[model samples]
Target: MKIKQGILFLITKSEVGGAQKYVREQIAICSKEFEVYLSTNEPGWLTEHVAGEIAGQLLDKRIESRTSIGYLTRLAKYIKEHGIGLVVTNSANAGMYGRIAAKMAGAASIYVSHGWSSVYNGGKLAFLLNRIERYLARLGDKVICVSAGDYEVARDKVGIAEDKLVLLKNCIFPVNATAAADRPAANGRLKLLSVARFAHPKRMDLLVAAMKGVTDAELYLVGGGKGEEEIRSYVHAQQLDNVHLLGEIKSFNGFGDYDAFVLISESEGLPMSGLEAMSAGMPLILSNVGGCKEIVVNESLLVNNTVEDIQRAIRALQHNYVQYKMPVKSFFDINFNLLVNQDKYLGLYRSLIK
Candidate 1:
């Protein structure tokens, strides 16, 4: 197992959300086997939240802090000067810059599609971006998809060739498994937790609306985003006493504070939060969308975006209508383990370099 010492470039728009977290984890792992150099607009809450040692290996390549031609030029210069062998871009904006920059710098470019970006949803701008992405796909040495669904969208909709695509599910260290297992259940009422940014795609509104129907359960909305004020206004206007907006929990171990986990997102790329919840042995109630269906295997309680469906899921979990073994450890072993999947990525990199 001779590890290569080639320079690797990791790019992301911002250190936020699942893509950011996934890139950070991969950077932490890859740094052990390669000289990993990271480039991003700025530090985000998610990047700051990771453990100190994992965060230390990341070398920030300062760009314009905004996704633009100026930033792309800066990234190109950095890649050339550093003799970067491989450029791995996480998410849409970074992918846009990294793909072109890697080509200019004579480095093998790898684009990691974390989810279907807003651009893929449909619009003149979205159409233009999708076209750009399609053209760029051919330039990339490899296009890594975070989920099977995302892979389909990249191939069928984005027009990326099948041979260029690869699936790499999101992975996280089950660091809190033991602590989460030790957490006591709610004595007075069941705690339902949703860990996501307060954004439209997350469909937190549906969960808030559904909570109106559940009198006995308490809902905790974690994470922050543009929709925070709107969510707060709805909570205050509705006067939902059972719902609590606890903001973002800075530590991964902080998840042990809850009983059950739920995510009502409209789309996802094998959400790590859900995996984290499962690792904690918490019963999960996820929206029947994207990789969520692949994760929530207990089909009996799968929820949808509709308020009625979410309400039904909450009620069902409350009444013991669904039962399934907690596959937390197995899930990690199957998907996230470095020994299981890192070698696959290493192989891909080596193949390209050869």
Candidate 2:
């Protein structure tokens, strides 16, 4: 497929998360098929992790009235100057500026909502976010939701047209299958996995609280984030020796260093990590929310956000690990693998440029 115009990928931050993962994978795949340009707040951690080479620019701007407009003008100018034909924005913040700038520059724009901001925020904040998304929806030529639930919110709550909203579930390039030792732990301890940025929605505290009295259970918290201090402080305060703050270790494949995988996020757009863990053959104890719920076919693994429910779910997995492993792998191979879904994304880009 010969491509005429460069694809500009605009995102708010370079932080490590599901949205960042999507950006990395998208660029890795798209760069092979087209010219990929990235614009973000800083050359974040993802700068080092992508699969292929990309041209990136730093466009830092506060989410304010005057400052945002200045950034928008600069972005529009950049798009026109670079001859960028398709502008795709990730996350809500970038969606705001990128969509409007793409409109001003006469470039086709697609806003990829990792998840609705309104779904995660509360009270007055949620109300404001709903209005912001509704406004951004008009500026974007197409709105891509990373999950079906997110797609529903884009149509029902954000008021994006059903025709304009597209559900492009997150996918990752398949990894070589690693042979992990059977059973969670030989020392009689249950190794639990939690891979997420230690951020607000991650709810690491809830995970720790659930671990309070669970016997022979050790929780390994992975990834770094702004919420690191809060999570560390809580773990220290509780004197929870069973919980090990592994920081960000690249070594632990969800199955090898852990017995079971778990993520109790408040909201998500079909998290790629859960899929990654499943590909590694780890049993899951997921929150009954968003993509995780959809990944785990068995309702037995899904639990509410309460500590008791999490504890109950974890205990159930610990007792019946083998029963859940098959379904987890089945879900990942069938839904989240990029090999099967890459053409759909490529065709979307091709259609836009055509």
Candidate 3:
């Protein structure tokens, strides 16, 4: 069967995080089966990273980038020019604009809800964005949630219909699975790695405070964000010698060096870092939020987003470290592989068209 022609519009303000990476990978995979086109802003790290593949597929534009007016104009023009049958938007900014543009252009639209960007936790601006999202959900043909937890929030809290929502688990390539079997023994110092942008919701401060009770073990803070300076200041203020802030290491070439991986986020849909950590054969310690508990299973430790809870989990994991075997990579291969999940998306596309 001849594949459909579609436009994958990514309106991420920044490209240095998991959502951008997810969009990029999805585009790459979907391109194999569809005439996939990408739309994103210029001068973004994501744009720069995606430049090599942008030869014929990418559309570079400096639109309102976030608001509907600027994005709808650019998106409508592109859809008209390319005969795009479907529009898929990732992230909140793109979801808003893409849904509106698809509606205006009379095209089918799928909005992927990565997470609740502006929740009750954020301030006035966040509340406003939340309202915008609720409005956008009503306009979209379908809203894709990366986790069931997120889907529930959208349905119950945001007033999106259950039928309008689709559950699509985040996909990850488990490159580390093969190498994990040959991993070296844990050194005397238990190494805990957290790979996430230093943002407000990530709550790295809680992790740092949790480390106070964890003796001798080292904590590696990977990834950079707006919270870098503040997180650094707090680390300095606390004299956290055991915590090492290693700014965003994109490739996990040396990931095996760490004994285990941990994340202490206030919220998430499904963090790719935790998935990567699991694939790398490292036991996971995650905050009991979002879909993390779903991935971690009994083999991993779940803690509340508090210093004491985090510290207790860390210590408990360290004490029972030897007994914990990394969850088998087969779990990811069977459930979260790109090929497998892509088929689910392809099925959704077919259903929509029919």
Candidate 4:
């Protein structure tokens, strides 16, 4: 019998965001061919979902600072001791330390940039971050970019070599229990849903601001983060009765009730929530940033995430909703389906070993 090679996945934190979810999906998909292990800064949603299913370790380091010498040393020792053959790092901080540690431990490393936030951030901080990312790219064998937009930015803007970067768009398993709801009557109010961590690049405030002019619809925001208090205060001060903060929901049972799904983020990397909504055949309204355009039903549904554009897109979707909503499942099936692309990942990993 042949021994299965060991694969270790690492991420900066284990929060239930897009990057964390990506790592979780990789663990499930790759476990079929390899011995899967996971390392996160601390145990949270990712750990919770994968608990008892794999060998998980805690790094106990946040994404805040540069690499820690002690953390790197410990990680290298763990990789060497466990016979880990491949180290897959997700997010910026993990990519930095994990790639270096993988090299030190004699493991091939792959860095998955969930989104190149540094390139889009703008100003001196963005310049410094891009330089840092460019320098760090040398430590990894390959960098997986989740969207075409990010891929272009990595190659063109960040000046990473074309051969070293892989353009593998994000994928998700379809939602099974839910399907798109029938459009509400012309006289009824539109029900819109958005699932996002209320933080930077996710302009929930813009969505709420847009809701002020949208008396004909109710917007439900389903997430919690550092930005929650600020958003709550803004909503209360603005007295937007139509907007409701639904917090985090782990199930898709209630998704079928919404007329449409909206994500007016300032930046994104092919959001899992948007794909989940589309898997349920819900129409998705997204901002024109990152990989959002790659999944939208139509260009008309793309917004600048401004209050004006969001309000406009909502009204447009409400006016001709069925036309926009009908093809959601088809779009998701063709582009973002995980079942179809799982082999691509397997092939990539296999090739890396050879």
Candidate 5:
């Protein structure tokens, strides 16, 4: 006899980011136990990547960040017709619509918050969404946070119940890293790689500024977002040729040629790229914000998210990198192992619907 399995996942953007990959990896893991479905808008990286893997559906009617009334009805109808027992949402926008639709369809809802949208610096719309997100926290049967920091913020500031919030930290497995040409051990020029969206709070401009003084270092900024042009203009204006924007690269673990990985985002929820870098045996220089702090425990590698501080950290790290190398990767193994995390998530999935 075949056991029943019905789980649907909802995400807003299909671009390849930590949140998208988080949803992808979870769906991949959960598919082993149940039938999986994905509902996203448009044709994007996520749509192309997950094609034919499971049942695919598209949410056509939508606003800039929130689902529309028509889309919500369609989603609920899809859920009811498919007999979906669980509806899990990743990213803030997805949670908003997915939870409501799940309720209409009589299914359990789970919201995986990458980070609270309100924490970062954004204009008016972001502020409004941040305000509304707190109310939605109570809609989910469980609100899964990717970092302890996010979990705390949701519970303390967002007014989510202590019992409803769960800390399910992100994990990495090094076994699947791509093979990039290793940098020469001599290392006269330190090459740094940062994989993050070019958003306002990402602070790539600070990284470029830090490079101006560090004559012995170069940086490759990967990923894309609305702020890409401004960063490029700043880099060009500063004449910082040492800084290169690789745009959005398809491969996440392709940092084989760099000396270290860096992320200076104003906010995060335990970035997947940072953990992947650690799993790939790369050291990190990160801002001590959100999940980045949770990923790297050692305080030395953490910067104050400023130009002068980052510059000093870069110059200092270039000299004493050998000492900080082992501890970074070791932390990933201890705290973010793949199988260890899989069991934790699997347990949550089983218990939530029951």
Candidate 6:
């Protein structure tokens, strides 16, 4: 019998987010062909879900400090000791340290950028970080971009060679058709859902402000983050009784009663929340940034991440409810389906192997 090649998946955070979800889903598919191993900063939902599937060893790759010599040395040592052939790194910190460590250990590395946050976020720090990313791209065999917007930035702006970059969009597992088929009857109120971390780029604050004008709709915001208190305070101050905060949800199952799924952010890299909502046959009202445009049902659903625009978008969605629903489902099936992405991933992995 042919021995399965060893592959190490390194991600900086163990928290529940889009990047963590991508790592978890990749593990499930890659484990079927490779001897899978995982390393993270600490234990959380990502570690918990992957525990049973991985080979019985975990590496604490102390990844908090990007300049930590110990971080590089320890991770490199592990790769050499285990004879790991391929190292797949997720997130920015992990991408930097993990790629260098993989190179040091003589294993091929692929840096998967969830999003080029620094470049897209834009500020003084962005210039320096973008330079650093361009330099680091040389250490990895290839960089996988989750969105077309990211791909353009990585190549055109960051100046990474086209040969070293791969464009693979985000995807989700097949949702239950029967469950997703159920549409709540149109009551007097228009029910809208926005699932996102209340942080930079994700302007839940604007969504709250937008809610003031969207008097006829009930806005359900389902996420918790550093910006949660701020959002909650604003909601309280405005006395926006129509805005409901559902906190963090482990499973998106049974969240299918909304008229439209909304994510008003400054930027994104193919958000899993949007894809999940699309799978459930819900239309999207997203910011026209990153790859959000790729998943939107129509041009009208893409907003400018402003209070006025988001308010206008919500009203538009309410007016043309039936037109958006079927297209959202059909688009998910054709473009962002699980089976299509699985084939691309497995093929990419095989090609990278010597």
Instruction: Output the number of the TM-score-best candidate.
Output: 6
lDDT per residue for candidate 4 within 78-194, as digits (tens), equals 888887888899877788888899889888989998778787765668878888788778877899998999899999888888888998999987877467667854667899999
Off by over 4 Å in 4: 1-3, 62-65, 185-187, 250-253
Tens digits of per-residue lDDT, candidate 5, 1-354, equal 212757888898787777778777777777778777888877788777667666656655372356378888888999988878888898766888889998888889899888877655435576566567766766779989888998888877666788788898887556376432244246578888999888856888788888888878889999888989998999899888889989987855576767788889778888888887887777778998987877775677889978888987777667777766657656777789776668888777877663
Model 2, which residues run further than 4 Å from truth? 55-66, 175-180, 250-255
All models: lDDT?
0.72, 0.77, 0.73, 0.83, 0.78, 0.83
Score candidate 6 by lDDT: 0.83
* Candidate 4 lDDT trough over 10 residues, lowest sum: 56-65
Of models 3 and 5, which has the larger TM-score? 5
TM-score of 2: 0.91
lDDT (10s digit) by residue, model 2, range 146-201: 88878877777767788788888887765555633366677878888888878867
Model 1 C-alpha lDDT versus the unseen true structure: 0.72
Candidate 3: give the clashing pairs: none
Candidate 2 weakest lDDT stretch, 10 residues: 58-67
The collision pairs in model 5 are none
Each candidate structure's count of clashing pairs: 0, 0, 0, 0, 0, 0
